[model samples]
Target: MPINADYKYIAAEIEFQKAETGAQKMKALRNMLSTAPTHKGAERLRADIKRRIAQLKDEIVKTKKQGKGRSFAIKREGAAQIVFIGLPNSGKSTLLSKLSSKKIKVADYEFTTTKPEVASIKFENIWLQAIEVPAVHEGYAEHKQGRQFLAIVRSADFVVVVVKEFRDIAKIQAELKKANILLRKTKEMIRFEQHMPHMVITWKDFNKKNLVRELWKAQHKIRVQTRAGHKIAPKPIVLQEGATVETVAKTIHKDMIRKFRFAKVRGPSAAFKDQQVGLEHVLKDTDIVEVFMK
Candidate 1:
């Protein structure tokens, strides 16, 4: 049976997915646990939430004990956060510098990058934040710094596994798996097909543009432009796929949801010019929404 989750639970889930820090994730998870349905069918869901909450608490404690004023946290920016992860000497920094157009230090030695290096890469009309995390190795999840690094990966919207050879992909994947980071192929985004469960792109065919496109598609998001009168907003509001008119209203203003009267739509989602839609109406990319308040 379906969980039939309510709006509060769904909103909490969105917050959890976008949370950048352990504290933020903890808050979202707590909200999810509180708002989740208290039905027999949802017992497993509740248990899973409780288990994750406990795990996060332990991780937070371990991180605090390990760090004495050091932090691995990178502030998320732009449309999305794409993390570049791999084993040592995997050319992660090379890809990061090329894509972001930033002068990042590139070296031949192992573990050259000791910390997280971040920059922004534009994808057509929007820009995305890209981060090259310190390399992963065997028993990485057990190490103090490695734990912090994996935390960053967990918060990323998309992950690109960089490697010098195709075989090295397995090594990186194994290390990431130890940290509970799962990688899956998004066939819809790119045409490359691999035997592994993770999305592994060939280094020969991979370039700055391809990386940007893959990140955009893997994010599973849509850009919606909210309109006022005859003028539309200069920047579109980024939201997850399947976002509805109610979702847009809440994003614009919390009160907009409560005081919602109706909304007028145009662009891709609308069936007719300036069509009237209710809160449940799903929005599409480039859709223009004009919300009316009671």
Candidate 2:
């Protein structure tokens, strides 16, 4: 499948958060804002990213003030860090309350959340951490406040943009664009092929005629290269239908890709088969992957 530009931004942000320098962090933030969807749904994300950038700047200042010998970095924890971004009164507190065990201040007004908050959510056997940041206005990043917020945005694993049903979507989009975020629409694709119930295989062709046969070809393929441009080959792993990038990484190698860098989609998005793409690219059934390192 062809990877959309929006997905690329998300993938870049995830990779940037793992970086240790202010310059790389800012570059990743720029990519995220440049590729995020410019819609009401993306408004929250715009705010969150802006806030994170500001926070990052503040960290740099603090580090400089403390002297260059001190390292300024955020220690990552949990399998995933989901960041909730939205405007004031966008139901972020409400949603967080329902999703995790953390107790956050919930109210009916704006700016209720003045800082970022973290919580733990357990899904099946996996425990994920969620981060909630302060609400931001349009064009916030152009100012000192926005620069301070960027610190938090650059550290999150994934972003959840929240918006109300009846809101000024255009205005929200304008704000997101000002922050350099691009918002795009996405649709789900489903594929059915006759293959082993659970196994991984790589094929040169994924045309409709050979779809059934591709399903049965199962042999572990080692990810020789990563999407983030890493050289080392990870462990051989199997790809299952509907498996998420994170799950795929676990099977490949331990500590290979800290989080999903980005995913390249192959087989069945367009007329071309074996299409390559970035991490933000959502995977369809029977998609071949070369997992990237973070």
Among the numbered candidates, top lDDT falls to 1
lDDT of 1 by residue, 1-294 (tens): 122555566557656766778889999999989988898878988898899999999999998998756487577767887778888887778878878879889888998998888888988767899888888889888888888988887777767777778888777767767777655546443211221222455568576777678678777788887776666666677899999999987775465677788999998889998899999999987798887766
lDDT of 1 at 270: 92
lDDT of 2: 0.51
User: How well is each residue in 1-294 modelled by candidate 2, as lDDT tens digits?
Assistant: 112223365355555655557767887787777776677756877788789889988987887798754222344544555566676677767766766777899987788987677777654333456677777677756766554554555455455555664243445445545655534432421111121122111122223234322222222122212232332222112233444555555443334355445555454431354454443344443445555444
Candidate 1 TM-score, C-alpha based: 0.69
**All models: lDDT?**
0.77, 0.51
Worst 10 residues of 1 by lDDT: 189-198
Q: Number of clashing residue pairs in every model?
A: 0, 38
User: Which stretches in model 1 have alpha-carbon errors above 4 Å?
Assistant: 1-70, 182-198
**Candidate 2 wrongly placed segments (more than 4 Å):** 1-74, 166-169, 188-294
Superposition error at 15 for model 1 (Å)? 14
